[model samples]
Target: MAEIKILGAGPVKRGVTQIAAQFEQGTGHRVNVEFTGAPTVRERVLAGEAVDVAVVPQSAMEEFVAQGRVSADTRVTLGRSRMGLALRKGAAAPDLTTVAAFKQAVAAADAVVVNVASSGNYVVKLLEKQGFSADKAVKQPDTVKVMDHVASSAQNLLGAGQLPEIRELVDKGVAIALAGPLPDELQSITAYDAAVTTASANAAAAAEFAAYLELPAARAAMAATGID
Candidate 1:
């Protein structure tokens, strides 16, 4: 059996982890997935890490294609994850029906916890464009930390991140989703893509795994976690 090592962005973790377990069970291939910030995945791959598969944001895939870091023909669209907001579990959920309402809620918070990952970065950019001070956010390196910041604080802090990440914390009773996704027009949806890396030790197995991600069953797994 081939051993497949995959490097993926943190926002896609839950869905990918679910799918990977299923794939391994069905095919008898050992699938090991490492989830980190999108930026870190890009850095490791560009630095010549030999992971069999790389699942990253579509924007990064474009760069990888240009650099020949991954096999062009094996790339497939994974799914898109929407940016969202969360707050402490016991706090009243905010009305996020409009961009203005969303902004006001964030502004009135004691502090905002956001990661430096894709969704977090998008939130910071949106805040900047809306004339909100980005400094008001407590920037962490990943979604786990963003949730941790909120869980440990008694202050009214908002956590802005990928919908799936926020959902995980909400399910754990540490936080509640302020919105499934931000207001449509103001939302940032990150499309993720996957492929067999050029540095893969088992290219054929990696290609098989990448293609498996496009299956209806796989999409369902992703959709269950707010990616679609």
Candidate 2:
């Protein structure tokens, strides 16, 4: 059996885990998966980690393509995801019907939990595009920290002036107040792509795993994990 390795971000981790399990069962391939933030993934690739395949946002994937780190011909976009917001379940949802309202909500928020290494950059960019003051936006280091602050109702509470992780907040009873779901023109979406590595000892199997990602069933599983 060919052994394979995968590098990915959290949002894609759940979906990739499901897909990888299925692929291994069908092909008898042994697969190893490494999960990290988007920026961390970039750093790992640059560090020349021995991975057979990788899945990441299209823009980051493109960076690899540009650097000749990934096979140009094998690049494929599997799915897309938009930015979103979450609030504590019992908390009243804020007004996001208009761009102005969204801006105001963010500005007036006590805290915002964001995935610093992965989604944070995009969120910051969106805020800047909307003319929101960077100095005023409350920042959290990572998703876990964001959740910890919100879950504990600590000084990092979004309502108290912070932006927490959308998914983590939702899991912790936070509701969607304002976010990057469709119809919100101020949102940014990132395409997820997968490709085989040039250094893989099992190139054929790696390609097979990459191809499996495009299967209807696989795509459905991915969507269930919020792959859009």
Candidate 3:
């Protein structure tokens, strides 16, 4: 069994985990998953972390490929994400029907949990696009801490060792909204790419696993988690 590494965001994390579990159960290959913030994952990859495949927001993928850390040809679109609001388990969900409504809701919040580095960038840009450029927002160094703030009652789980789960925040009691979907006009389509690491011990098997991520079984797994 070849070791596979994944770097992804929250929504896709569940899909990846499900796919990995299924793959291992069916093919006898053990898959190890690590979930963390996207920026941390990107930094680690840039810093020379050994990764078999990386699942990141599309916004970050191009930059990574440009830096030679990811293979341009192996990239694949994982799914889409929209900044939706999350309230603690029993908290009332915010109304985000319009940009103005969204702003009002955000302005009325006690504390906002946002990731300034990765996921937060998109939210900030969305806010700016809506003409809300105030710099005083609940800023966190990374998504993990932001998620913690979003829902401390619920444990945060990291996917692909870099991505976070939205449910984690909803479970805790954080309201989430986005400026837009993750990638500018794409409704937050975070594409995940898999490539055999340069130092992989089983490059062939790793490639196969990477290819498997695009198969129906993998797509089904992704769909199960609200990603398509």
Poorest lDDT segment (10 consecutive residues) of candidate 2: 156-165
Q: Compute each candidate's TM-score over C-alphas.
A: 0.95, 0.83, 0.76
Question: What is candidate 3's lDDT per residue for 1-228, written digit by digit as tens?
Answer: 666776554557677888888888878877878777767777877775777777777767777777877666666776664444443444555555665666676666654556665556656666566565555346777655665565553422111112225654444455432222222231333445444445345556666677788898788777666665
TM-score, candidate 2, is 0.83
- Inter-residue clash pairs, candidate 1: none
Per-residue accuracy of model 2 over 1-228 as CA lDDT, tens digit each:
898999876567767888899998999998898877778888887666678887888888888888777887777777776666655544556666677777677766765655566566666667677776675445666665555555566332342211212543455553333233423586666678888867667788888888888889898988876777
Across 1-228, the per-residue lDDT of candidate 1 in tens digits comes to 999999988567888899999999989999999988888999999987999999999999999989999999999987888887787767887778798898888778887788887677778888888888768878988888888788778998888888887787777776455554689989887899998999999999899899899899999999998888
C-alpha lDDT of candidate 3 relative to the true structure? 0.59
Model 3 misplacement above 4 A: 128-136, 142-144, 151-164, 168-189
The true-versus-predicted C-alpha distance at residue 208 of model 2, in Å, is 1.0
For model 2, the stretches where C-alpha displacement exceeds 4 angstroms are 129-131, 154-183
What TM-score number comes out for model 1?
Answer: 0.95
